[model samples]
Target chain A: MSEARKDDTILDVKNLQTVFFTNSGLFRAVDDVSFNVRRGETLAIVGESGCGKSVTALSVMRLVPDPPGRVVGGTVTLEGTDLLSLDEAEMRKIRGNRMSMIFQEPMTSLNPVMRIGDQITEVLRLHQEMTSREAWAKAVEMLRLVRIPEPDRRAQEYPHQLSGGMRQRAMIAMALACRPALLIADEPTTALDVTIQAQILALIVDLQKTLGTGLILITHDLGVVAQTAQRVIVMYAGKKVEEAAVEDLFENPKHPYTRGLMASMPAVISFGAKTDARLNEIPGMVPSLTNLPPGCAFAPRCSLAIDRCRAEYPPLQEVDGDHFAACWRAAELVGAP
Target chain B: MTDQRPLLEVTDLVKHYAVRGGVLRRRVGTVHAVDGVSFSVAKGETLGLVGESGCGKSTVARSVLRLVEPSSGAIKLNGTDITGLSKAEMRPHRRSMQIVFQDPFASLNPRMTAGDIVGEPLGVHGLATGRAQQERVAELFGQVGLRADQMKNYPHQFSGGQRQRICIARALALGPSLIVCDEPVSALDVSIQAQVINLLIDLQRKNDFSYLFIAHDLAVVAHISHRVAVMYLGRIVEIADKTELFANPRHPYTQALLASVPVADPKAKKLAPMIDGDVPSPINPPSGCAFHTRCRYVMDRCKVERPTLVKAGGQHEVACWLNDGTGRAENS
Candidate 1:
């Protein structure tokens, strides 16, 4: 609590480096990642498949697997305590109690054999030390809070008995059973229907606000990021390419990759196409982690790449107040054509 | 949306798969997968079919390609009826129409190299042999943005986006007049998805082939499609031009579907969901209008009467009772 003001920081991560040791070489899944989440703030990590956004979140929770994936260097400080320094037993005590995670696939996350009621109550019993009757009652209450119709009846049903949306809501209820100080939702509604996705997203935002909980939403969908996150970190090839306030990021993107991403998205709301060919696709492929290009990893694909960019890696630096971008030509990219 | 010289016209397409149960394994009832769907794809035009998961949009695509035998309908390719043609009789007509499936990896044979995968169509149809097939395959590979040297590489050697490019080259082997794309880019990442979409658009412009693009993502569909069809529970609820459909969606379901899509601009005010409740079972669908169960403006009449696709404004059509009485307003 003395490390930083309680009002300023709820979770702070510094120099996070997650790597995978393969036969080919050492692959840095999350390279020197750093960020912080203020209390009750929603921070979204935006990236494509291999961008290490998920790895960063996993690194925060200390959930990185050992052999292949190891959080070699990082300080995931939560409420003045470094999660990385904590032992397995100490971390487990705080895992679902103070910090919880909701995975992308709800079907795979929840136990098929356990009833929805028991799942939620299991978290309550473990974290809060509630009695069987008290936990069961609270479990039903949480289900009702998530707006699951007939919560009492749904409590008895197994995971298979519920719809995709219902199963996800159950997972949310279980995650929020203890009112965790922080919630990590990795593509929470990607697998659900669009209609149901809206409902779930709205529910999560509302609940997080009501509980005053910090949230880290990991997703590839920019639309969802725009709608949900106050601030966003755009990751590319295991490195932070750009970070800015959501509004600033969308309105005037700094990095070429960020701009390309914004342009590539098909008109979500077709308000008379402004550009001839709306989608400006980023050419070439996302470079392999093992054999990344020399200097800037994105140099091979970057349209604005220069000789200097190809010779040395670009460090993520502040272009303006609270807006950071890792590109050699970040200054020149402002007011880009 | 019907233009001159329609390349593909599907009329009253219906496909009902049998559902069997009990000890005897007798036919209990029918799934009613695709019930009375109709659409036309003009020459060099793209017709996007969009709907929820179990909405039978894929069934319509499959039915049109004769991949699944329709219970009743007429499939006209270049104004020639190929509906009742037997396998041997329809063999040559297959050149006029082709299909590209969803999964890029699954669609391509793992054992076959990229060259073999794209060149197999030419060999199967006996259109070319040896050196000629090799030349055509190399040409297609280059056209789809893949290197000619990469042809020897197997499907597993390439990434998802490259594999999809190979699949597109395969679909283009015979220069088919119509290509049915069933969620081709759904599986790839957002960045890679754009490349594949751009490739498709470029190929369409150069080669000029009509497309029956089926997908659930309205944004992607609206980008490539000339006309868009919104399906719900085995029947299309609304059909209109891409801009018209996205601009002024008449049906409540269409409105909801469009609203459900989260806009990329965070500054915009959040759109509250118009309706709630999951899609009812297709096995035992609701009586009368299929969407009536979820429609916010549901009426007593909607429960008893099945609404048909009535002409609304311009080329737009809606199948809801709200648009029934005053729906038939001809613009011309």
Candidate 2:
């Protein structure tokens, strides 16, 4: 990569792997995943449950619980610094300062007993050299930035006292209080109503642009990905099955799994259109990550799977410029150009 | 085929729970869960009721099935008023109307086999027994696209989608004319959700049954329902044929909801401007029109007087003042 390109890249994750050990045996939760987020761009990691999307975010933050899970291999490079080699103290200083994350559920993520303003102020005090009064003022300002009405009054309220949408806004305020270069949000708007979800999504996108922050949005909703993300990564059973620009992936998905997922979603029909169409189904359930089939993880459910698919795992190959797929018959897939 | 006479009719359904406060537990206010709601289902039609949380859609479903007693209303099933029936008389009516809950895992008893769970309804109503019930159970299993052999396993052994199928099979065992499905496929994954939805549609075709399908997701509702009703607070804001409702929504709430749905197309146009505030509390809901707090076209009369459903055009009915000749002249 050129030096200028490296300078623009805010987060570069290469060959990432995370594994968990249970009584049933150890299984790879995230396997050989790689991606990069440029400054001011939104990169979405889309997948179903247990497909290791959330684990990938945790791995990047070095927040994976150690007893049963660990990031065994990979290099997470954040703005020219190798995060894996950093000591605990140094990593703590970098975290919530240069990078931050917003989890899916705000009710549990925020401290229940503490006032919302205090929670945001704690991050400012711990990470930056700010006095108590300065931190409190910055905390209220952050709430205002997230479009929370009555920021001064709302800052004194507890998490439970506020509505679901308000709690989520507070979470965003706390996450963005430091103005981090990289923001990782895992399904931030999944719990709210569609109207409220639109409000929250618009807020996130607007803030990202203003701050010039590189965003890593992890979600299972295809509609959200299409509306918000610039680039996309499709994951299936702990592997990156396809990667492409949002338009290219939706228009011409190269991987069979990606194509199946898109087909399964029932689109909101246009006005006055007939409603006789049945939604396309991917016949079988997602394979268990612990006891996966030998070759491709998705072979049992893929309609195009052949003998070769069951015999060998396909390597990620470039199907077109900046578009990649891990399917053995990527060229033969019906939507592939 | 839809019959001339509707299979179920719910008229002026009102259910309210009292809110107690202080040490004496005095009735301070009432939570208007479902207030004066009315709708009907044809013999084989599916009526999709959609709204956000705390909007009383679930309350309407529960009232229709008489699971929770409604404070006041008339529920007529097959031309018979079943609202005032005693528990003993309601037993026979229960066989004709069944309910499928959202969480399949919590609904089914873990200790019981899938076959026994499906056959429980038969035994309860004394519809079948012995080898006859076994044959009926196996038939229902096959009807729901589950293998007869898998019926011997417990609910734990089955996947989420399979558990939902078992719930459907149980509901089918009674041979009901109407089934109230409360977010049946919301718990499943996207791929599995599609499979279950297809199965439901196919089963409805074969059995010629009516469904009062309730969900918060509009796309799924658009695909499955013949007619759609949009609920706000505790009232139906708009009700119309699926095509008409989506194409020409008259109510401000209904229009805002349709515009809020994020389309799957990446290059799709920007989302329409959405409503600003959260749904108000149901306990002390906004007076007069419940949706005036967030409505964009609210007028002076809207805050003082409530609007009832009136025919806008064709079969479409809306409760907004704008559509009832009270607000804007262009809309009237």
Candidate 3:
């Protein structure tokens, strides 16, 4: 949890800025975002749709293509080495080996033409330089590790022959084939059903514990973060508004946006209560990144906004022990810890 | 219990699609998409149908509406058996029961404006003409939380939440007593989802319209439904009051589903035994209990003899062999 921990700093991002140049204008999808992932811990980047949570994860893996999106500034350091400085070949070597990423949709991520085992072995053969027989054996082992039933039979089936949950398990098996130290799962359980989602979550938790792998979970659902994440970072309009321990963030959120999100979520405890006429909601849509306000991006919709909030941008200040919030009136609005 | 006449009732409904194969295209198998499913919505109650994808929840919704013709069953709307009614004969009852689809973008006609979309039902049923149709459309716009003046705007001009509101207005044009809402809020953002849910609740209160709300979201379903029916592999595994279903689910599938929902409270530490393996395909479902393949407490007989839905307690029914007073029933 510390910035100076020697073995804890698995992935460090500094002043990351990602911009997309389109026909309309230049838009900052991720603006000066900075965060860190500790070894063997889950760090969740939580936000609404289009809050740069996914873009930050893509930037970390260098997955964003060059024509529309470009990393204009910042550094991504993995195990004390700057990944941005690496050449294409070196980065490719590091991609599936040292750091791997799982996409949102497993159905679209897996190739339909390739068998599940071949796809998994493709990574092993490319990175580990193993023989075909050895790679196939390793692929079967990986499938079994992911709890796939009848691993030998499942390995020979194509991606289309599997169900949504099975395809996701296969995707995870492929990502973990090289035993990466850092895993970036982008909404891995978003499209899955609740029962299957719980299984997948438990699998990730078990795998992280077994492998001591650092995790960066990006999702819009607060429920997923509450169940899995250790530390939480809240983003809005491509800016980090709050960061705190998972327990502290939910119990005593320091930012208005975080409070609104928590209040808007319908919980089992609050079911069938006819107490209030109006539920807590943040009015208005998220502002376009291209047309962001100069000072505070959320000022237009924030009820507690003041003149000072509209004149200057607020810095992320440490309000409590290991808790950071970027709001001018954080202490007044949320009360001092 | 006081009123025996429900707005909509489905009894022993079944739908199967024949799978063809080989060079001559012979029917080799049948996919039992909806097999012997039954549920009912009272005069003003919202009955939520929730399950995983490919669990036949949508098929039940479609069958009740007679959209995809049911192979065999009885669907009664206002005491009239419309299951065997021909297309021409069923046209009169179309205004009594309507549907609101999940995807607002795909459901609404792109070339038509909001006015035309909402007024189509009115024109089809000959309920109103020219000026009256325009007035009805404007009134519906205001009812579903949209501005009457924006009726001329197209679906493309509205946000996802607003477009769904337009769809709701269209469904309300015929003054239907029942509305089949199939995942209406699943495609929307969380904030917008709350808005749409609240709107649906409000409309139901004001108009006394019953809803067969089908969705995959447990929390949202628990919020708006009076009674809930949990489906798994084309079967209604559990049916009970919303409070009882959430608090004390009897069926194993329902228990696992309720347990899997991530609680908002950080201090909560309850975890259920997660079901393993994917749901078996309906085309070739397991011989006995379709859920036995993934169920944690699967018995030997579960792999051979299917269970029947029966009354367990007060207003609660379950279709599990465990609740039938026998550890496992003998296979026939």
Candidate 4:
């Protein structure tokens, strides 16, 4: 690879929009969202359920269902190639070869009938053009890379035979086996215990650094976003409310929604400061996407909402160097001492 | 306003399920779900039980409430041993102990209105009826941060957070002294989770009821609990005051559990996992210490000798050889 290409962005998404035509009406599950993933960078999309984080990921992968859901608009540029313009056959060649995804609940995602080793070997054989024996060896090596004990023996076991943690490790192995440039993990460790979560997270970070894979992690846990992500995008009602470096987001959140999330989460380590006071709560629930409030979607629930906020949606603007927030009162937050 | 007497005391609780297999349905093996667990919740105190899935924390909660009859144990409520009481005899005892489950959507009856669901307990206990029951139900709803007008709504009509509030209202209708909350807030979203936690804390302060709060989130437990008990496999490995336990965990499992929690700070450096591998199955748990399979400081003695919960210092108690001062000298 050329020096310039080595440092180039792996995934560039612009004006991404996905909608679901439910029985009630059409709702924008992913409103015009745009973000870029640099080479070997980890970009986290954090939001509660119904915030369209998962839809954004599916739109990027071009895996959105068409009958009820579709990526109505977007320019998903992968390594200078517009993935949105590719045909089904062409997209298939690029999917497992250039980008792959890890889903939550490995039991549902992984083939229960197939052996773990055979499942991974299938991906390698299909995308990498490897022979049966070579693929089998590589599958075992990938399992070993994920730190699975007795990789050779475990490869022959079915998904049910492994524990929950092991099943997730197998999923990670399968996702990274092809060494795709972009890896999208949706709530990868939400089902596992904290200890198991720690192990899996450490393995993913270590492997991503070694393989230089651009990771797009979608999760609701702020703690996870703080620990792993280099950059984060905070979504609310299917729109990007805030985007900033991980440190800046935690230290100085501009959007009221982002600030609410940070305030609500009970930090495990408070550096000796006592938090006996009542936890700050975001007053109303997330509005239904189909019946979102006029103008700003978050205006109803936001404490900093002004008359202008209810009259029109606030355009996402730069609050600081590279820190963007879509809030009418973001200037007030920045002006705070 | 705290009392010396414990609101609920559980001693030597053991709940085992016999796994039946083969054509004749013979007992193939025994799953020691809750093996010799013991704890006490003082009056007006909240005891948080923290553990991973399949760690028998749920079993402990159910046993305390007599929802599942323990295979063997003594469960005393306000100095009265209700463990051996029959269903008819346990009716009044049930009024003193209620439970709030994790999934409010599944726990609540969809057909019933929120008011009826909350009032059912009042009707069941024969405590109130007619206008009195309606008033009590409305008051319960208000206490949990729900509107009285919404009492006519069904469980499906409410949001996830609202459903949990209904569950809390139902749990509070009986005016129980001890409420066993099993992951009551885990199902709610992060923003809504804080609302429920704050409500629970405020309710505890006003009502002065003891709580057996079972959860996997250490931070939530640390915030709400007066004392915390860490369970691994089927045993309580450590129990201590919230601050003491969080600041200085004595057991290796407790320490690892704390270190495993991802700090909400990007600048915080990542540390290596203290232990590895998944939690072993409860049916065929390791011999000696249940956590020995994942302990970073494992020793040969830990493989053969089981450690019992012993006083380490102050109010803290740990069931590890490293701190118990028995098997460590020989191994060292």
Q: Judged by TM-score relative to the true structure, which candidate is superior, 1 or 3?
A: 1
- DockQ per candidate: 0.60, 0.67, 0.45, 0.67
**Which model, 2 or 3, shows the larger TM-score?**
2
Tell me the spans in candidate 1 whose CA falls farther than 4 Å from its real position: A1-6, A274-278, A335-337, B323-332
lDDT of 4 by residue, A1-337 (tens): 2567455788989999999999999999999999999888999999999999999998888899998998888799998899999999999988877999988899999999999999999999889878999999999999999999999999999999999889999998998898899999999999989998889888888899999999999999988898889999999999999999898898889999988888898766543544345888999899999898888998888877889999899999998888999998887795211
- Stretches of candidate 2 exceeding 4 Å from the true structure: A1-4, A270-276, A334-337, B1-3, B269-273, B326-332
User: Which order, best to worst by DockQ?
Assistant: 2, 4, 1, 3
iRMSD, all candidates: 2.0, 1.7, 2.5, 1.7
Please give the ranking of all candidate structures by TM-score, highest first, separated by commas: 2, 4, 1, 3
Model 1 per-residue lDDT tens digits across residues A1-337: 3455456687989999999999999999999988889878999999999999998988998888888899998788988888988999999888998999999999999999999999899899987877999999999999999999999999999999999989989999999999888999999988877888888999999999999899999998988998899989999999999999898888778888898888788875665763125477888888999998889988888899999999999999899777999998988876532
- Global lDDT of model 3: 0.86
What lDDT tens digits, residue by residue, belong to model 2 across residues B1-332?
A: 35487889999999999999999999999999998999999998999999999999999999888888999989999999999999999998999999999999999999999999999999999999989999999999999999999879999999999999999999999999999999998888898999999998998888889999999999899988899999998999889999888877788888778888888889994644479969999999898889899988888878988999888877888888874542232233
**Clash-forming residue pairs, model 4:** none
TM-score of each model, in listed order:
0.96, 0.97, 0.95, 0.97
Q: Candidate 4, residues B1-332: lDDT per residue as tens digits?
A: 25587888899999999999999999999898999999899998899999999999999999888889999989999999999999899988888888999999899998999999999989978999999999988889889999999989989999999999998898888888999999998988999999999999899889989899999999899888888999998899999888878887888888889988988888885746768888888898898998888887888878888889888877788898874442222123
Worst 10 residues of 3 chain A by lDDT: A269-278
State each model's CA lDDT, in order.
Answer: 0.88, 0.90, 0.86, 0.89
lDDT for each residue of candidate 3 in B147-186, tens digit (9 for 90 to 100): 9889899899898889999999998888889999999988
Query: Which residue pairs clash within candidate 3?
Result: none
Clashes of 2: 0
Q: Supply the TM-score for candidate 4.
A: 0.97
